[model samples]
Target: MNPLTAKRIAATGSAALKLLMPGLCFVVSSLAAAPVSEVAEQFDRHFEQQLVEHHIPGGVYAVIEGNQIVRVRGVGVRARGGDEPVDPYTVFRIASVSKTFAAGLAAVLAEQGYFSWNDPVVNYVPDFSFRSARYNKALQVEHLLAQTTGVIPNAYDNMIEANVLPDRILPHFRQLDPMCTPGECYGYQNVLFSLIEPIVQQTTQKDYATLMQELIFDPLQMATASVGMEPFMNSANKAMPHVRARGGWYQSTVVPSYYRFAPAAGVNASAMDLSHWVMAQLGHYPEVMPEHLLATITDKRVRTVRDLRRGHWRQFIRDAHYALGWRVYQFGDEELVYHGGWVRGFRADVAYSRDRQVGLVILLNAESNIVSELSTYFWSKVFDAIHIAEAEQFSELHSTEDD
Candidate 1:
């Protein structure tokens, strides 16, 4: 909230991060012990012995269970050419991972009766209008969060990239044709998705950033998480994003372009902060993120077969769908709620399984496809370990009957 406090939070980067429990904590059935957990065994070797040795800049990853952060470690420096090592608490812009927080905030407000999901968007921001008067009246708070506005995907996002304000971009929507009737299908959006900002701000009579802080971050104890560019740029122990050029990673300055859409791409957080976020999604904190709220936000709404075909995610994903702000991926019979984010020089992936009570968050300061590969490989191991343990348990039970 304040400059001094933000710096104090950043100062926490120096705290010694420890491996509390690679302690065979992986969950199998209630009656079963897991096949010796191997998901994190080569994690350090992959990052320290491999990624760092390669030309990439920096990143941080944390493994968290529903009730505790299992292990968190940062592998590289905060900036490409600087000596400030990235620790678990080093703040990085999470990009579109901010959408989860936005949707969570909206759900928080909705539960408080500040506004209803079915409420028309025009009630909050009367200035916003669509080409069709019928569609304008039909668009509701839930439609934007669910990505079913029937607007073209990423509508006017290029204007945001060119440093245009959303107010300027809002009027242009009046000129476009609908892709589908409201709530009929899925079409992703950045500028359009953020219409929730005006809705939340107006209904509660609070700024969007302040509401997110009061409702979500504070309740979840995400101390190092902050919204907007000022806190991110002012924080001393923040990760500077990198762009690959001239055969090496180079430090890149944070641009205000995406920050203009705070609800869409402007939240900054540390791995320490986001570990708590992932844990909350696993339903650890009921007061802040209750089961009802979780169910509302992550309830499968629209098919997203395309996301299942992402680079490393394609083969294993049996099905995929979009919820409020999350993606529900069917991994065999288990469900994984997940999202990934990217901007100029950053990439982030957050995912968790409610059934298993395990979650992982990965943040990278440089743009690299390696993050995708690494995330895919880790989750694959976790799923594999679960299956093998179940098979072994079945075999043991069958043998016991024979004996």
Candidate 2:
């Protein structure tokens, strides 16, 4: 009726719209957020199926997102026909995954001026030698961690596997010929890689195990992480390594010789402890995993000839390369930092995406091809979940604009 009354009614309507808009936006945002628990449950189901299909005796895995462990689970028994079930606390030998720790520790020590990655190995271990005088003179600390020492790949693995003492193996480096100049090629190493132990020992006046405990395990509160066969076997919650027999998995006797190459393959830990290790690697704990140090260790130092198309989720992997102690894979546009380990009957895989702040660690007591398959499946699921959440958020934003 009256002009003034009409204006007052219009103002009240505008105020109500403003008040309601925020609640509406809140609802839309909530709808866009992915249900993490649901995704985790789905992953658990898939993982369980995989364990059964692969006939794995025992396994444990941890999935990490940002600073949190989103999933921590285990399937199957600790030993074939044994009543003990695998769980987050059950420890397994991480094998060559231990090299990642060695690289990280070297980076930390380098930052503190203990040694440089490029420092000559001979400077630390003056007795170090190679059949080729050129390689003997040119070999640097970085070359060892990168597995680019120009020595034949796994040249001494047979000896190591045969239970030859590492100290005895050390002097035999003079007997093996260099395949190329140091840092020119990629070669997977075990005995030569353990040379980092002597370098670390000489620089810090402490053994590699003590250094890892002081720098990594202690700070991250990885209570179950340790190096050496004695501690691993003596631990109450350790998994018995297993191997596939004629028709099924069977437990294997512990081999103590690998402990001598502690820097390369001796670290043992549980999935629960490794979740924290992954979190630190993902930059959750800056004090423990300094950005510069991480950057140094994760630098793409060498190219690998690994074919991604051979795996189940081959479509996602574009290329693969090797960083110091870790492998880097191009997954679409994102980079996956990964490493896999095999020692006797045990197998391990660890991987993380820096951009997504997501990671996975899988440990199995029985040797099998399941680790690679499960890794691919796990990453596919994670990327799918992230994409779905993003799509929902985009829809919500556009709908709000139209309204």
**Residue range with the least summed lDDT across 10 consecutive positions in model 2:** 22-31
Question: Model 1, 86-183: lDDT tens per residue?
Answer: 89999999999999998899998899999999888888878888877778878888988999888988999899999998778999988976788888
**TM-score for each candidate, following the candidate numbering:** 0.86, 0.85
**Predictions: Cα RMSD each:** 10.5, 11.0
Give the runs in model 1 whose Cα sits over 4 Å from its true position: 1-37, 385-403
| Number of the top-ranking candidate, with TM-score as the measure | 1
Instruction: Name every residue pair that clashes in candidate 1.
Output: none
lDDT of 1 at 311: 78
What is residue 45's positional error in candidate 2, in angstroms? 0.6
